[model samples]
Target: MKQTIIITDCPEQQGWQKNRELCMDVTTYLRSDSRMKAGKSYQGVLRRDVTCDEMHYNEQMVFIETSNQKRMKRNPRIFEGEHITITRRDDGSYHPNFRPIHLGPDFNVDHYATEVANELLWGLEGLVDNA
Candidate 1:
């Protein structure tokens, strides 16, 4: 099954920075997966770019270079390789929610992904509070 995890940072101070860090953590998770590897390292355009018309003004786009482009283009649902977005709330408080996108019947994947995502958020709470 395919799944997408969207981790939003709270609206507190330095929320954008924290959100970026959490996104990095997600990337770390993807990197550790045996089925996946970091795609080509390309300089991503900011949301201000013309191609980013679909994204909100606050959204930052990061391109993921993947191995199996054909599979991704075909199935699209598999979380095996995808570029994810880490969104920040307009209120400036990090959104503590971790949204699961295109989840499948595998309870283990849902459970484990949510578990790790929440743990990452919890770890950020202390850091965000301190900052």
Candidate 2:
């Protein structure tokens, strides 16, 4: 299945000190047949207006695949009009073309998606029926 997700903001690019992972403000529903409501915890390829040459190196500045305490260096730039086209697999895993950034351990997709949905659905308690 193919789904388009709208990205509004990235806290890490906005100078969020405690934030490390690259989380986006999604404004699309994942499972519902609704547009511009709230996105689900789905991961996919995000196409941005900017490009990043991110690389991970070790203490000796040598490129390594996996490292316990890896050091990463990259030219991080954020631009407007960033969105993603997520591709779903048979195993129900969303794989994006871009690599996942892990600077810290504070970014959670489910938590962020829930927060966005709650914010957008706020003040509409009467409009939506729980039952």
Candidate 3:
């Protein structure tokens, strides 16, 4: 069984380091669920690049790179091995204008996304309290 998970309609890609913070936050849960000491699979969703007709991932895809592919113009961090990758694929399961991608099986994308959203959103309750 392939371990994969996806969360559509994720939080906005804004704010100072918000995306990175959130990813790091989610990475915690992943560290606990994976059967492997470390994950070996990469996952993410595919969406059209707003700047062009080309396709790109909505989020950074996780990957474990061991060799330096300098010719490919990959990020320097990924060459460190076991790190999130900034990669986009040309093929995937297409539906309408988006493609669903999973970040391996270490974490449940659907469940964790909901859990994280709820956890974060709960703080907003005070702002809505009788406002």
Candidate 3 residue pairs in backbone clash:
3-104, 3-105, 43-102
Who wins the TM-score comparison?
1
Off by over 4 Å in 3: 1-105
lDDT of 1 at 97: 38
Candidates in order have lDDT scores of: 0.41, 0.37, 0.35
TM-score of each: 0.22, 0.17, 0.18
Model 3 TM-score is 0.18
Question: What range of 10 consecutive residues in model 2 has the weakest lDDT sum?
Answer: 76-85
> How much is the lDDT of residue 120 in candidate 1?
62
lDDT of 3 by residue, 1-107 (tens): 34544444543433223233254212212322343345554333323222333575343333332332236432221111121122223442211211234578686
What's the distance in Å from true for residue 33, model 2?
A: 61
Off by over 4 Å in 2: 1-104, 123-131
Cα misplacement distance, residue 61 of candidate 3 (Å): 57
In model 3, what lDDT does residue 57 have? 31
